[model samples]
Target: MTFTYQMTVEDAVSFQKELIHHTEEHERRRKVWMKYMRAILIGIGYVGTLFFPYRPESTALHILTAVTVGFLFALLLTPLLNDLYAPYMLRLNRRFLQKSQTWPKETTLQFYETHVEVHSVSTNIHRTTQVPWASIKKVNEDETYRFLYYEEDEALIIPKARQGISEAEQLEIDQTLEKYLSTSPNV
Candidate 1:
């Protein structure tokens, strides 16, 4: 089975955001302290807000209020800041971080019994890569995309929209992945 689709910078940014969100969720799940800390911070902020106008003379309460406000600001602003920064980061990655100047505009994925072949085409170049089933570290899906993670941070992003793929093709791709990936030790 084969699938081809266009990939834009927006797709890259969306993938990055999703990856970051997933990583954050995983960390939040793995680190029990982080969950407790967030709860404690919220509690402090709520309590401090209630007491802030009532008892201005309490030095410890004042300190707690200041700390809580600062922490809350940081927590709230981090995601907003990341949203603003992601596009620039993606641009920088395309221009300097990548080995090739020509980014993949159109990608073709050919799924075989044992491996998958990726063909990426840009204005200046055409590149082909083969990834064995054993090398695929993970397979992830969201509402808009299917991610085949070959490395820890790298993935072949496949859009789930009705671009060119039919339902039958999608099902076939899913079955092929499950067939190979289930047998592979890495995935």
Candidate 2:
């Protein structure tokens, strides 16, 4: 499948939102859970007189406070952490946009069995590259777009409304990517 298109910050913003939704569920939860677990262990060690010069009676109070504060902070800050990611990603992509000016604004994407080929053609820029399926970190789809996250803080955003990319064609592209890329996309 091949599609040709241009990009904008709005496109980048939409993809960033969906990507954050996916990461919050699959990635952030695990990290927060691990931190809480570590806090519990550290609290226990403190109570056991392993590090602090405190009596057994005072150690319990200190452990309880440590555990409470740690768990509460972890639970309360998940959204803040998730929210921070989007703006950071937007900033990074905006920076990428600055660099993108040197390359062609028009992009052609070719999806293959084992890899995807991207070629850009412009007055002064003619760039061609192949990205293997394994390098794609994730795929995401929503009502208006499909994002092929193939690099750190970067994605190939394909608008469903783009010319020549019909509903059926978009579905085919999604399925092809799901099969060849890392895993089934977050639809």
Backbone clashes, each candidate:
0, 0
Write one digit per residue (lDDT tens) for candidate 2, span 107-166: 788988788887766658787878787887877788888777777556667677776577
lDDT of 1 by residue, 25-126 (tens): 534543554445456666666666765556567779776777778579547754554454445545655555255545547889898877889898899788
Clashing pairs in 1: none
Alpha-carbon runs more than 4 Å astray in model 2: 16-104
Q: Rate the local accuracy (lDDT) of all candidates.
A: 0.68, 0.67
State each model's C-alpha RMSD to the native.
7.3, 8.2
Tell me model 2's lDDT, rounded to 2 decimals.
0.67
TM-score, structure 1 vs. true = 0.58
Using TM-score, give the best candidate's number: 1
